[model samples]
Target: MWVPAKFRSKVLAEPVRRPQLIEHSSDKNKNKNLETRPQQHPILSAQQHSISQELHGKKPAVFKMPVDYSKWDALELSDDSDVEVHPNVDKRSFIRAKQNQIHQQRFERKNKIETYKYERVVNDGLLKRINALLAALESHSADADKRSPDELMFMAIMETAGDSPNEAPPPPPAGVHTQEKEQPTYSKMMAALVDQVKAKVDEDKPENRFAAYVEDVKSHKAKVEDLQRQLLEELDSLEKEEGRKITSENIHTGFDSSHVTKGKAEDKSTGEAKKSTQKAQTVEVLNPQALGKPLLTKKSDGQQSSGADADADEPMGGDDDDEDEVEASELGKKFASIKAGDYRTCLEFISQHPEVVAEKETDGLLVLAFNSAIDGAYELARQCVHQALLLQYCRALGRDGVRMFFKRITTPGHQAQKVFFDDVNSTFARIKSRAKEIEKQRAQEEAEGTGGVEQIQLHAVDPNTTINIQIPPENSSDPAEIKAKELFNAFPPGLQRALESGSLDEVNKVLGKMSVEEAEEIVAQLSEGGMLSVEEQIIDATTEEGQKALKEFEEQEKAAQQEQAAEQAALSKYSDDPE
Candidate 1:
C-alpha cells in the first residue's frame, strides 16, 4: 500500500533497531555469474556483436580474423571489472506508475475544486456578516441622535421586559377603546340605536296636521286649474270678439261681408277661365318655337283659306285708317278716364302693344310720357326714368332703342313723334344746361353734408326698399327690378351725393327735385315703350344660368355616351373573339 509522504516519513524516521537485509535467491546468483563470464577477444567480440546486432538494433563492426581456429583463440582475454546489472523491471513499473499518476492527478483536481468551493462559501458568509454589521451600525448611528425620552423609555422597557429568558413576556397594555366607558359587553348600544332609529322613522310619519295641509294644497291646485280654465275661456271669447270687430271694420263703403264673398267667387271663376285660356294659348305658341321647326308651312292652302274666311266674316263698315285712328283715340281716352271697369281692358291693350310710349323734356327735366295708366302706371314710369337716368349719367345704355321700344308697349296710344321728337329736341338743350347747374349745387351740398364716407350708400343693399317711388310688389314686377338697378346706377354722382346728404325726405328734393311731370313722364315713357328684342333678351337672360347649366350637363352626357360606346366596342371585340 502507498502511504502519504508525511506518514511514510514518520514511520521511516522511527527506524527499526537493525536494518532489514533482503535475501537474494539462486536466480540472482546465476545472473551474477553470467555477468562475470570472461570477455571475448576483439574478433570474438565483433562476432558476438554481429550476432546480437538484431537485438541491439545496430550495424556490426568488421573484425580481422586469424586463419587458424584454435581452442586458445576461443578463450578470450578477460579484465576483472566490478559491474552491476539491474534487472529489467520497467514493464511492471510502467503500469503501476501510470495508474498512480492518474490517481494523483484526479486527487489533486478533486481537492482543488473542494478547496475553491469551501473558500467561496467562506467569502459569501464573510460578506453577509459584513453587510449585517454595516446595517446595524448605520441604524444605531441614525437612532443615536434622534431618540426622544419617551421613545428611549419605551425601547428600554421593551428590552427589559422582552429580554427576560426565564419568564413569559408580560401581556401588552390594552388598546384604547373608541366607545365611552358606559358601553358594556352586553351592548345596549344596539338597542339604544334601534330606539333612536325608531324615533327618527316616527318623525318622518305624516301627522294629522300634515295630512290636512296636503289636502288643502290639493284643493288649492284644483281651484287654480278651474280658474285657469275660466281665464282661457274668457281670453278665447275676447279674441273672437276682436276678430269680429276687425272683420266689420274692414268692409268697404258699399260692400258688405256677404257681397265680398260673392265678389271673390266671381273673381275666382273669371280668373280661372282666363288662366286656362292663357295657358292653352301660351302652350300653342311655345310648342312650335320650342321645336324650332314650323308646325305647319306658313303658305299652306288650308291656313290661307281659313284666314280669308275669317277676314270676310268681319264687319268692314269703317275705313281701315279711320277705324285704327278711332281705336287709338279710344284707348287714349280710356287712360284719361280710368275706371275699375275699363282698367283691365286698358292694361290688356297696353301689355299687348307697348310701342306708343313717348320721351319728352320739359322745364329742365326729362319726361317719359305714357298714354295710359292701368292700376300701376306710376311704377312703370319710375322704372323708365331710372333707365333714362342711367343712360344719361352712366353712359351705359349706349343709345339702345330697347328701353324706348318697351315703353311703346306699356303705354299704348302715346304719340311717339310729337312727344319724343318734337318736345325732346326743343327742350333738351335747356334741360342739359339746367342739369349742369343742378349738378354743381348738389356737389356743393354734398361737400357740406355731415355724414362721412362710411355712411354713404354706394350700392343698393335691399333693392326693393331703396327707391323713393312706391311701386307695389305686383306692379314693380321682374322688369322693374332691372330698371331700378339701372337707374340707381345712372344717377349723376352729384345727385346721388345730394340724395345721400338726406334730401331723401322728399322725392322732389332729390331725384324728383328736377320737376313734376319731368320725372314722372320719363318713367311713363319707359313703361309704355316696347322692344321685341328687349322682351326676348329678358326671357333669355332670365333662363341663362339654368340654360348654361343644362347645356353643360347635356355635353357631359354626350361625352359619357361616347366613352361608353368606345368601351363597348373594345368589350365587344373580346366577346366576339372569345380567345
Candidate 2:
C-alpha cells in the first residue's frame, strides 16, 4: 500500500529526536556558564542534509524516525490491494466479455432460425405430397361417376395439415359442411364448388345496374332493326329501278308475234323436186322456228308467168335469209347484255365487301358464305376427298375392287396418294376428338348459361374457319361412313339443319321440335344436294315464268284495244246524230 501525498506532511510532522554533539573549537567556547549554542548550519540545509544522510544510510539516526516526503515527490500512491496502476482500463477484457455475450445471442438466434427452417421444410413437404395425392385422386375421379371430390380434397388438406408441424389445420369456410368420411368423385367436387359459388353469389349484392342493362339491350335491338330496314329498302329501290328500265325498253321491241310468219317461203321448183327424189326419212328438215308444214309452192297456170318471174328472182331471195341471221345475232347480243348486267350486279355486291369475297379468290364464292373464315381450307379439302371417295366406292362394283383401288391409292410414289391412309385416319381421329371436345365445351358453356348455336354460325358462314372435324376418305380401308356418323352424332340436329339450309328460321323450328342430332342430319342433306342444287338454281333463275305472265298481260291489252275500236265504230255508224 502507498500513502497519499496529502498525508505525507502529517507523517513528517511526527515527534522525532535529533542527536546532540559537543565540539571544542580552537577559538570558540569562551565561557563555561554561557550555554553553548549548538554549532548549527542553516536550518533548512541541515534538514535537507539529514534527509539525504538518512536516505544514503550515513546518519546514526533512530529506526523510528519520520520519513520526510519533501524530497520524495516522484512516486505515485494507491490504497486498495486489488487496484493496480493500469495505463487505461483493461478494454481487451471488456471487449472479450461483450463478444462472448454477442456470440451467445447469435447461437440462440441460429437455433431459432434453424428450427423455423426445419418446420417450414417439413410443412412444405407434407403440403406437396398432399397436393400430388389430391391431383392423382382428381385424375381418377374424373372418370368416376359414382363419387365426388370435395370430401377427398378436404380430407387430404386436413390430413396433410395435421401431419405438418408449422401449420394448424383449417376448418371449412363458414356455411360449408364436410361430407361423411368417404372418397369423393370429380363430379361431386364440381357440384360442391358450384354450390359454393352460388352461395357466394347470393351473399353479394349485384353491382350492375338493371336500368343500364335494359337500356343497352334496347339500344342494341334498335340498331339491329335499323340496319335490317335500311338493307331491305336498298334492295327494293334497286329492284324498282331495274323493273322500270326493263318495262320502258320492252314497249318498242319488235319481236315477231307468230312463229308461222317467221318461216322462210319455199320455191315452187324446190317443191316439185322434193316430190320427185326426196326420201321421207331423209327429208331436209325446216328450221326449228318454222312449223312442220311444207314450204309455200307457186300457183298452177294463171300465176305461172308470175311464178317464173318469182323463180327468176328466187336467187336474190337469199338476201332475205340474211335478215333472219341478223335478227338472231341481235337476240344473242341482247342476251349477252342481260347476262353482263346481272354479273355486274353480283360483282358490285362482292366488291363493296372485298374481305367477304376474299375466299372466292381461292375456292371461289361457291365454297364459302362469309369473308371472315379463311382458315377452313384443310377441312374443306378433307370433305372433298371424302365425298369423292364415297361416290367412287359406291360405283366400284365390288368390295375387292374397292379395296384394290384403295391399296393402289396408298402405294408409294403415287402422285395422288401423297396423303397416306394413315394420315387420313389420323385426321379423322383428330376430327373425332375435336368434335368430342367441342361437344364437351358446349355442354360446359350451357351449364354455365353462356352457350348457344354460335359455333354453328362459324361453320355455316365462314369457309375459312377450320373445322378440326374430319372423316376418312372413301377409298380408305377405314369405315368413313361410320366415322362420319359418329362425328355427326355429336352435334345437335337443330344445328345440323341450320347448316344444311340457308334458313335460320327453319333451323329454329327444327330445334323446337327435334334434338340437335336430328337437325344435323337434315343439314347433311344440304351437303349432298351440292352440284344438283347448283344446276337447279341456274335454271330456276332464267326460266320463263315472267315471260308467260307478260304474254297474258299483252293478250289482255290487245283484247281491250279491239273492244275500244269496235265501240268507236258503233258510235260513228249507229249513235243518234248530235242534231
TM-score of each: 0.13, 0.12
| Tens digits of lDDT, candidate 1, 263-284 | 2355458658866775554322
Off by over 4 Å in 2: 1-93, 140-579
lDDT of 2 by residue, 93-157 (tens): 65566557745654554444444343344334433444444444444444344443344344434
What is each predicted model's overall lDDT from 0 to 1?
0.38, 0.40
Q: Tell me how far the alpha carbon of residue 49 in candidate 2 is from the true structure, in angstroms, after superposition.
A: 73
Candidate 2 lands at a TM-score of 0.12
Specify the highest-TM-score model's number. Answer: 1
